[model samples]
Target: MGRVGVDGEQRLLLRRAEELVERAERSGRAVSRHFYTPAEQELIAGAFRGRTPLTLEFDGGYEGAERRMLLLYEQGEIRPEPPLTAVAIEFPARAAVPAHRDYLGSLMGLNLKRETIGDILACPQSPGIVFAADAVCGVLYEELREIGRTPVTARPARLEEIVVPEPDGILKRATVASLRLDSVAAEGFGLSRTRMAALIAAGGLQLNFRPCESPSREVGEGDVFSVRGRGRVVLTHVGGNSKKGRTFVELTCFLR
Candidate 1:
C-alpha cells in the first residue's frame, strides 16, 4: 500500500494497506476501499489449491483483483475489479479513443499489445484504452494538441473523459492532423442542396461557431461546428495509420 509490500505475513499486509487508504483519503488522491482481510487471506491460498501466489495491480483500477476476490465467493471471497484496471492511461496530455464498454472488457480477455493497456469504463459509457509508457502516450498527446485537439491521458484516462456528441449536436468539424473540410461541407450547406437549404433557411446551423450563410465552409482545429436544433462538436486529432495499406486519419469528437 505504501511501497511496503507484505510477504508471508497476512496481518502485516492488512495493517499497512489500511494505513495507505487513510493516507490517500487525506491527500486527495484516488483511494482504495477495504480489501484483503486476514481471515480471507488464508482462504484464497487454500482454495487455489495450497496457497497460490496473488499479484496486486500496479494501479488498483482493474477488476483482475476482483476476479480473484470472486474466487473467495466460491471459497475465499469474490470482490469487484481491482484498482489496477480502473484507469487505462496515466499521462495528462493524451488523446482518447471512441471505444465501447465491451471493447475495454475485451481488452482484459485479449492480451494487450506491447507497451499498451486496455480496460472497460462506464459512466461516460465507452471503452477505455491507454498506453503504459509515458513517452509514447505523451507523444500522441502532443500531436493531438498541436493539431488543436485535447490530448489523451497517460494510461489513466477513463472513457468518460471523452465522448461523441449526441445527434442533436453533431456538426462538421476537424481535429488537428486532419485535412480540409470545405468540400465536405459544401453539399450539406449549399443552397442547392434541399436538406442544407432547408436547415440553413431555418437559420439553425453554425460553422466554426459562427452562423454561416451555408454549409460549404472551411473548418479546422478549435472550430466549434454546430447545427441549430442539433448539437456541437470539438475535434481531437487521434493520429494517423494505414488501413488496407492506405493512409487514414483518426480523430475523436465530442457531440452535444
Candidate 2:
C-alpha cells in the first residue's frame, strides 16, 4: 500500500476528503471514496477534528479491516451500501501458496491503483479473498488470471464468503530496561538491540501503523510495532519492575 507523507499528494488527498464531506452536507446525500490506508484514514479524521454533527463511516467490507473506504452522509439520510466488491482468487492445490505481496504485485501489474484495493486475506489452503472497489471488479474478473506465475481463477464473492484466518501469534513475557521502541521490539521479535535499531533506522518498522524511524521513542501499552518481514508485535501489557530494575512487558507476535 502507498504511504501518504507530508507532501503535496497528502495535501491533495486531505483536500479531496474535505470536499467530499462538504458535498455530502450540501447535497444531503452520501458520498464515498476508495480504500484508504490506516495512515491516510488518521489524516482524514484529524482534518475533520472539531467539526460537529458530521456523519462519517469507514468500512472495508468486513470488520477489523486495515484498509477502508470513507463515507459521508446526512444525519437522517439512510446509509447507502458501500461501493465494494469481494473477489475470490483460487489457486491450484498443487501450486505454491502466494504471499501477500505476490497477489498485490499481480493486481498492480493490471494497472489497478493501490487505493482501489482493500485488505487481501491470503488463505493457506483455500481461495484468497480481495476486497476492492466495485469499479475494478470487472477488470479483475476479466484480466486477473495469474498471481506470480501461479495459475488462478477469479470470481465475485459475497462479503460473508471471506474467511478471515485466525491470527497466529506467539505470546512472550520478557523484561526490558525501558519501553523504548528498540528494546521492547527486540525482546518481542527475538532480535538483538543493534539489529532492531538498524531496522528502525532503515524504515523497516512502523509504530502504531505509522512509520517511525526513532528507535529511542517511548512505547506504552497497546503500542504496535510492525517490521517489514517479521510481521507485527503488540505491547499488550506493562508490569512492575523486576529485581534487576528491568520492566516486565507482555507481547503478542504475529509472524508473516
Candidate 3:
C-alpha cells in the first residue's frame, strides 16, 4: 500500500487480514452502515418514485466516488449545476511524460515540478488542467503538443520512455534502474553487513528477482527497488557528477 510491487508476502498478509476480518464478523463486531432503517427506506422509496432527492446512505469508510456522492447529498438538491473544473492530466514521474490524447476529455497544462505537485492539484479545476496519473509522465513532449498540451519540465530537454509504473497502486511494475542504500544505517536492517553477508537474502529487495544485498550496491537506473518498511522507490536518473571523483548519483523520488 505504501510502495508498489508484486510481493508474495504482501498477498499472504492480506490473506491473513481477511481471515481476521471473517473472525471479527463471526463475533458480531463488523456491521455495515449503508443500510437504512424502515422510515428512511420508505422515504427513499418515495423519493425514487417521485424523482425527488433521496437521502442516500453510505458506509463510514467512503472514498472516491462514494465520498463525492455523500458530499453532494449534504449540499442539498442538484438545482443549478455546480461549477466543475475540466478534467486534467498530470505528469508526476521523474521522467518526462510522453505525448498522448485525452481520448477521454479536455486537456489542461500546468507548469509544475515533480515536487510541490499536491499544491497544483488542490487548485479548483480549470479547462487547462488534466490531472494525469503517474503512468503518463514518460510521454514525449512533441507527441503531447500535437494532442494540444505540452509536458512541463524542471529543465529543458527531450527524455525517453522509461516504461515505468505510475506508482499509484493500479499499474503493474517492471524493472527499475537503480536504488539507494542508507549510508548512515550502520548495518543492514538490524544485522551487521558482514554478518548478513553470504545469506540467501533472495527476495528481501530486488528489481527483477536478482539478489542486491551489499550496502555498496548500485541499484542502476530504472530499477524498481523495495524495502520492507521504506516502501517502493523507482531509481529515476536526473543528472549527476563525481564527488571527489567518486560516482555520485541523482535520482527521482516516486512514492508508492
Candidate 4:
C-alpha cells in the first residue's frame, strides 16, 4: 500500500488494509473492517485492487448514509457481523420530538463525530426514533440524557424493532430543455440555469455525494446532486418529452 506522506489516520487505514490482505492470505477466509468514510472507502479499494485479487464489500447502515464501513473478503469465504447497531429513543408522546438535529447534537455533544453515527429514522407516526451507529453502541444507550430540552430513554434495538420512515426530502416534477446535468439540476432545484452552471464551475456542488464540477454532465433518473449552500436534488424519474420537446423529470430535493 502507498505510505508516502501518510498521516496517522491514513496510516491506520493502511494498516487495516494490510491486515485485511494478510488475514485473507493466512486463513484463506474473508475479513471485515469498520469506520471508513466514503472517500476512505475508495482509497482502500484502490489500494487493495493494486495488491490482491480479493473482492471488496461496502455497506452503510442504510442506503443513503454518507459514512459506511468496508468488508474485505475472499470469494465464498466471508460472513461478517452487521457493522452497525440501532438505538431507540423514547420520549413523552406530548413532548416536542427532536428531529435529526437534536439527535445529532446530543451525539456530537458527547464528542462523537458524524461518521460514528448513521441514518436517523424519525417520523411523526413512529412511536420512537432510532439511529444506527458502530457496534460499540453502549455509549449512546447509557450516556445520552435528552434531545435538546426534552428528556428521553434509549436502548439497543434491531432493524426490525423500529419502522423506518422515508428519507426526509420534498418531491417535485419538472420539465427541462435538456438532460444535461446542469439543466436538470437547475430545474429540479429551482435555480436559474446560469446559477447552476456557475455553481458547478466554481466547484460548489457534488454529484451522487462525490465532488463534481461539470455542469454539462448528463443527469439520468436516480442521480443525486448535493449543492454546497443550497441543498440536494435527486432525480427520481425521467418521462417522455412533452409536445414542446422538453423532458419531464421527477426530483426529490433534500435540504441540508
Tens digits of per-residue lDDT, candidate 3, 228-256, equal: 55445444442443444333343343333
For model 2, give the 10-residue run with minimal summed lDDT. Answer: 1-10
Residues 167-247 of candidate 1: C-alpha lDDT, one tens digit per residue? 332333322212334332332233234465456546566655445565444455454445644444444332343444322
Instruction: Give residue 195's lDDT in candidate 2 (0 to 100).
Output: 97
RMSD to true structure for each model, in Å? 22.8, 3.7, 20.0, 4.0
lDDT of 1 at 23: 51
Report the lDDT of model 2 for residue 191: 92
Give me candidate 4's TM-score against the actual structure: 0.76
Clashing residue pairs, candidate 4? none
What is the number of backbone collisions in each predicted candidate, taken in the order shown?
48, 0, 32, 0
Q: Can you tell me which runs of candidate 1 are displaced by over 4 Å? A: 1-202, 238-252
Better of 1 and 2 by lDDT: 2
Per-model TM-score on C-alpha atoms: 0.22, 0.82, 0.23, 0.76
Task: Write one digit per residue (lDDT tens) for candidate 4, span 90-189.
Answer: 7788888788787778878878766667666765533455545555367777888888887877887656666766667888888899999889889867
TM-score of 1: 0.22
What is the descending TM-score order? Answer: 2, 4, 3, 1
Cα deviation of 242, candidate 4, in Å: 5.4
